[model samples]
Target: MIRGVRGATTVAENNDVEIIKATDELVKEMISKNHIAATDVAQVLISVTNDLDAVFPAAALRKIEGWSFVPVMCMQEIPVPNSLRKCIRVMMTVNTSIPQENINHIYLGNAVSLRPDLKAE
Candidate 1:
């Protein structure tokens, strides 16, 4: 069965370095926590908030080793009132047998507040 893993992280700044660092951490965390390999990931879709125009999240994702085959897309997250800033969100579609409930979703920094119910213990 195919499954999807969701994750989000907040960058300390909109600069290229911080943007890539935070996004890289979030991607690695989501994959490692779920014990999924790069080969298993079919595609990745990422969106950044309006405050994060310094770079494209997809470009950062593609820099991961062995991810050349992974299809990645970057888009702008719909702005809303009082939404989190400098946020990068991702949805990874993977070919996995894991049940939906077993999938791990990652949220870091202030982005954790975006999904408080998924907050770690």
Candidate 2:
């Protein structure tokens, strides 16, 4: 079976370091919460708000040990009017038997406002 684990986070600025750090943190949390291994990941799709173009979020995944071969892509998020800014979002497709509803969707930092319902208490 295949499932998608979603996560989103916000960075304080558009700096490469901040973007990479936030992306790494968000993806790691998604993997940890879902008990997913790098090998189990089929692909990772990452999107960042237009304000964030300092770096490709996928760069963070490549730095993770064992994730060198994991397929990852990064793109710009749609600039919806009044949307959240400086946000990075990730959707990881993985081989898993876990039920969809049981999958944890993580939202951290200012990005929590993007999905208040999914934000951990």
Candidate 3:
């Protein structure tokens, strides 16, 4: 069955290094925590707040050997009052036998507070 894993992270700076690091951490955590196999991942969509412009965060994931073929896309998040800045959010579509409740969602950095209901143990 196909399922989606959602993750959100933030960058303290707009530099390329920060962007790549945060994105890499968020993506890797989501994949690892859920024990997601690369072949099971169909597509990944990333969105960044308007405050970011680090030449597309997905470029960094391309450096990972196993993730080379995974289709990735980036988009600009809509600006909303008092919204988080330098935030990168991802929606990954994957084929998994696990039920929805078994999937893990990652919210890192400043995004951790976004979903206090799902706080990690």
Candidate 4:
């Protein structure tokens, strides 16, 4: 079966280094812990707040080992009033034999406070 893993993270600034580092770390952790290999990933969609540029995040994922084959796309999140700033959200679909509850959906850094209900237990 195919299962989806959802996660979101934030960057302290709009700088390229911070964006790349945070995105790489988040994607790496989700795939590694869930035993989801690049070949198994069906698609990876990333949405960044309108405040961010998508190039850095896309480049970050491509730089990672084995991620070259995975299809990735980036989009801008709608600017809702009072929304979080500098946020990067990722939705990934991968072929998995495990149940959804067994998956570890990551929310790290500033994004942790956003989803108090699902913080790492």
Task: Give each model a TM-score.
Answer: 0.93, 0.95, 0.95, 0.92
Best by lDDT: 2
- Candidate 2 or 1, higher TM-score: 2
Give the alpha carbon lDDT tens digit for every residue of 1-121 in model 3: 9999989999888989999989998988898888887888999999999989967999877976688899999999999989988899999999999898877889999998778676543
Give the lDDT ranking, best first.
Answer: 2, 3, 1, 4
- Per-residue lDDT tens digits for candidate 1, residues 1-121, read 8998899999887898898888899998987888878898888999999988888877777788888889899999999988888889999999988788878889998888888877543
Rank the models by TM-score, top first: 2, 3, 1, 4
* Model 2 lDDT, full chain set: 0.90
Candidate 3: residue 67 lDDT (0-100): 89
For model 4, the local distance difference test gives 0.86
RMSD of candidate 4 to the truth, in angstroms, is 1.4
Each prediction's Cα lDDT score?
Answer: 0.87, 0.90, 0.89, 0.86
Which 10-residue span in candidate 3 carries the lowest summed lDDT?
Answer: 112-121
Residue-level lDDT of model 4, residues 1-121, one tens digit each, is 9999988999888888888998999888787778788898999999999888745587878988888988999889999999889999999999999888887888988888778777654
For residues 6-117, what per-residue lDDT tens digits would candidate 2 score against the true structure? Answer: 8999998999999999999988889888999998988999999999988888999989889999998888999999999999999999999989888889999988887777
Candidate that would win on TM-score: 2
